[model samples]
Target: MTDNRVYLFDTTLRDGQQTRGVDFTPADKIAIARALDEIGIDYVEGGWPGANPTDDRFFSEPPALKRAKLVAFGMTRRPGRSAENDPGLAGVLGSKAGAACLVGKTWDFHVDVALEIDRDENVQMIRDSMKLAAKRGFEPMFDCEHFFDGYKANPDYALSCVKAAYESGARWVVLCDTNGGALPHEVSEIVAEVVKVVPGDHVGIHTHNDTENAVANTLAAVRAGARQVQGTINGLGERCGNANIVTLTAILGLKMGYETGVGDKGMKQLKKLSRMLDDRLNRAPNPHAAFVGDAAFAHKGGLHVSAVQKDPKTYEHIDPELVGNQRYILVSDQAGRSNILARFTEIGVEIDPKHPKIQRLVEDVKEKEFLGYSYDTAEASFELLARRTVENVPDYFSIERFRVMDERRFNARGQMVIESEATATVEVAGQRLHEVAVGNGPVNALDLAIRKALSTAYPSIDGVKLMDYKVRILPPPPNSDGTDAVTRVMIESAGPDGTMWRTVGVSANIIDASIMALSDSLTYCLLKSGTEAKVDA
Candidate 1:
C-alpha cells in the first residue's frame, strides 16, 4: 500500500448484517464479497464466524477474491479465557481468512459494567488476541470499540488499550465510534492524540450514523492522519447504520485527493454497487443519498437548470459521471423552457428551444402535473408524451373496453380469499379480441387480461413483466374532480433481457390510473424491442 493510499475496509457483511431486517444468506455473503473484491476494496470483513451458521458456512467456503483480503471479524477472548483456547478466537483462526479483526472494549465504563472485568485484564485481552492472530498467520487488526467515548471518560485507559494492541503486533488499530456520538472536531482532536502513540498509518476509523454524522466523523479522522476507513455499503448496520463507504470513497478519492484502492475506474462502479445491494434486499434506493442517489445531481428550478446546462460546476460539486451517476433535469410546474429543452436533450429527443412543439409539450406536461402526474420520477412517461407529440408512434392496439371485479369467497381449502378478475376487449389488425384473466389484485388482473388479448398477435408481449408498482394519493385536482383524492401510479417493468423502464399514470380512480400505467409499461417494452411497428401494420 502506498503511504498516501487510504485502505477501504468494507464491513457490510459483518456490521451491516446487524441491521434489523437484513439477513444475508451464505450465498448472499459470497456474492457481496465478490462484488467488493471487484470494486477493489482493500479489505472485506466476511462476518463473525462462530456466531451463526450462515457466517460459518460462508467462511468454510469463502469466495476466491481477486483483489480484496477477506477479513473475519470477532471479539477478543473473554475475561478469564486464554486466547489460545477461546472458541471465538479459534473460530477466527479456523476461518482461514488472510486477516482477522478483533473488537475489544476500550471504554472503562464498558470494561467495568459490560464485561465486569478489571481494566488491566481488558488490555491483556487486546494484547493476547492480536498476538495469537499474528501467530496464526493472519494479519491481525484490533478495533478499539467505543474509543472516542472511552477517551473522553478515561483517555489514559483508551490510549493504553491501543498501545497494547500495537505493541502486540496489530497491523491496524481502528478507533471505533461505536455509539456514533463523536462530532467531527472531537474526532479530529481525539484521533490526533491517539496517533501520537500508535502512528497514523496503523490507525483506522469505524463509525455509526446515529447522529447522522458518521461520514463527517470518518473524514475528520482521516484528516487527523488515520489511513484506513471502515464502513458499509449504503451505511447498513444496526440502528442508524455504519458510515457509508460509497459516500466516503467519493469524498476521499475525488474531493480530498486521497489515494484509495478504488481508483478512477473502480469509482465508476460505486453507483452500480450501491444499487445492487438495494436490489438484492428488495429495498428502494434513497433518491437523495449522496453520490449514488437518483437525485444526487438532479436539477429542478429553472435558474438552476439553466446554469447547470451552461456550467455544471455552478450547482454540482463534482462530475456525476465520476461516480457512475447522471445529471437529471426535472420538468415540473416550476420549469421554464430551459428545463423542457434540457430534459428533452437528456432523453435523446432533439427539440429546439423555440420550436412550437416545445411549448406544446411543456404546456401539456405542466397541465398533467397539475392533475397529480410527477414527471421527475416518471421520465419514461414524459419521453412517451414527447414522442407522441413530435412523431406519433404507431398505436399497436386500442382498448375497446375493460372491466375488473373483486370477489371474496372461500376456497376449496375453506380459506377466505379475495380474487380479482378482469376482462378486456382490444382491437388489433382490424380484429377484435376479448380476453379475461384472474389475478391477485385489480391491477394485476388487468395487466394479465390485456397481455392475453395481445400476446397471440404480438408474441413479444409475453416477454414483459411488471417488476414493481407504487401508488401515491394526491389531493383532488383543482375544479375538475369533486372526489376526495386522485391516484398516481408508477409501474416499473422489465424486459426478458433484463432491461427495466418506469411509466406513470394519474386518475381519480385507482384502477384507472393503474391500468393506464400498466398499459404504458407494456407499450414501452414493445417499442424498445422494435416489435410495436411489426404488429400487423
Candidate 2:
C-alpha cells in the first residue's frame, strides 16, 4: 500500500499579508507563526526577509517552531544578476529559516514580456538559486509562478523550469496557478504531466481562488500525485484569495484519508485555528465555511433535526466533533421537540425528552426570538434561559439598580477628555453591596462596577474578560417610532482557560440591554467554573 503522505505548507504570514486589508506587524507574525507550528503545519512561510520593515523584523528573530520548518519566501535571482549578488535571493538566503521558497517565472510570456529576458536565462536563474540555497544549508523549494498557464501555452519550457530546480537540489518544485483561472481538470492533467519529470513527492500545488476553484484545483493536483500543498489560513491572499488550508486540512484528514503532519489531536483544533485567525484580524468568521464553520453542522429545519437525532449521518457527511465543531440544533418558531432535546444534550442539561415543561421552554424561546433576541449566535444566553425555566438556577448575584454618568472635562494637563462613571447596587450571598467605578466608556464603567461588587464574593470573575460586544437595533413594535425601537446586545467573554461563550440581551434602552448581557456573561462564567453560591437564610 502507498504511504499517501502529504506535506502542508502555510503562507498566511507571507501570501496572506497581500490581502487588501491585512498587514501583519512583527508581533502578529510571531503569534501567527507559533500558532501554525502548534497546529502541526509542515512549513511556516514567514515572509520576504528584506521586502519591508515588518518582514525584516520577523526574520530577524523568527518564532521558534517546534515541528514545522520555518520557510523564508523571496524571488529567484533577477535577470543578468549573479545568484550570489541578487539582493532578492540574498534576502531569503540571509534569513534564519530552515527552508526557502523562491518564486520564479516559468511562463515564456512572462519571461519575454514581463522580465524581458531570454527563456534560457530565466531557467538558469531558477537552477542557480536552488543550488545556492542547498549549498547554504537550506532546504530549497521553487515556486513556478504561472506554471499552469505556462504549461498550457508552452509545456516544454514550463517543464524545463521545474526540472532545472529539481536537478539543482530543490527539495520541492511548486506549480502555481498564478492566474487562478484553470479548472480542476486542467490542474489534474498538468500536475500529472509534471510528476512524470519530477517525482510526486517533490511536487507541490499553490492556487488562487479567482474562479472559486482554488480548493478544487488543489485537490485535483493532489489526486494527480502532488505531495505538498501550499495555502493560507482562511484563504487570505491577494485578489479573491488562496486555497483555504483550514478546509483542506479537514478534507484531507476526514474525507480523503491522507496522512498529514496534523494528527488527530491537531485535527480537533481545526475550528479553533480557523477562528483564531479571524479573531486576530478583528474580522467576523464565515459561518458557512466548509467543515469548521459555525453553520457547517447547524440543523435548522424540524425534519432535519428529527432525522439527525436518530442518526447524525442522516444529514451530516462527517461527525462535526471530528473538527472540533459541535452539532447546533437551532430552535425558533420552526423548532420541534427534537431541537429542544438536542440543545439540552449539547449544553449538558439533563432533562427528560417528555418533560411537561419542555414545551413551555420552546414557547419561551420563540417569544424571545420574536422580541429581537437571537439565540443562534448567543447560545450561552439560550442555555441560561433553558436552565432557569426547568432547573433550580441559583441567583448568584442580583443587580437591584444601576446608573451611569458620562461627562466631558479638561484634565490637569488641560487636555479635553471624556469620562464615565457607574454605580451598582447589588445583593450577593447574604449582604447588600454598593459599588462605583470609573472607566473609559459607559459600558466599561458598568462592567467595572459589577466586578467591584462581585470581586470579594467571586474572585474568579477577574480571570474573565469581555472579548467582543455587538449591538443591533430591531424594528419598532407596531406603530412605535424608530427612536423607541428595541436594541439587542451580544457580549462574547473568554475565561481563564480560554473557553469563550456568548450571551445576549434585548431592551428598548441600550444600557439596559448591555447590562443584561454583561450580567449573563458573568453568571455563565461562574456556572462553568463550578463556583458554589452562598445564600444566607
* Residue-wise C-alpha lDDT for candidate 2, range 1-537, written one tens digit per residue: 254999999999999999999998899889888888888999999999899999999999988889999999998998888999988888899999999999999999999999998899999999999999999999999999999999999999999999999999999999999989999999999999999999999999999999999999999999999999999999999999999999999888789999999999898989989988998899989999998888999998879999999999999999998888988898776777888888998888898788999999889888888899988878888888889998877789999999999999999999999999999998998888999999999999999999998998899999999999999989988977778899999999999888889999999999999999999999988888888886872
Off by over 4 Å in 1: 1-3, 477-484, 532-537
Model 1 quality (TM-score)? 0.97
The candidate that achieves the highest lDDT relative to the unseen native structure: 2
User: What 10-residue stretch in candidate 2 is worst by lDDT?
Assistant: 528-537
Predictions in order: lDDT:
0.90, 0.92
Give lDDT: candidate 1, residue 263: 78
Tell me the tens digit of each residue's lDDT in model 1 across 14-111: 99999999999998899899989998899999999899999989999999998999999998998889999998789998886999999999999999
Q: Which stretches of candidate 2 lie over 4 Å from their true place?
A: 1-3, 25-31, 57-67, 279-284, 429-434, 456-459, 478-481, 529-537
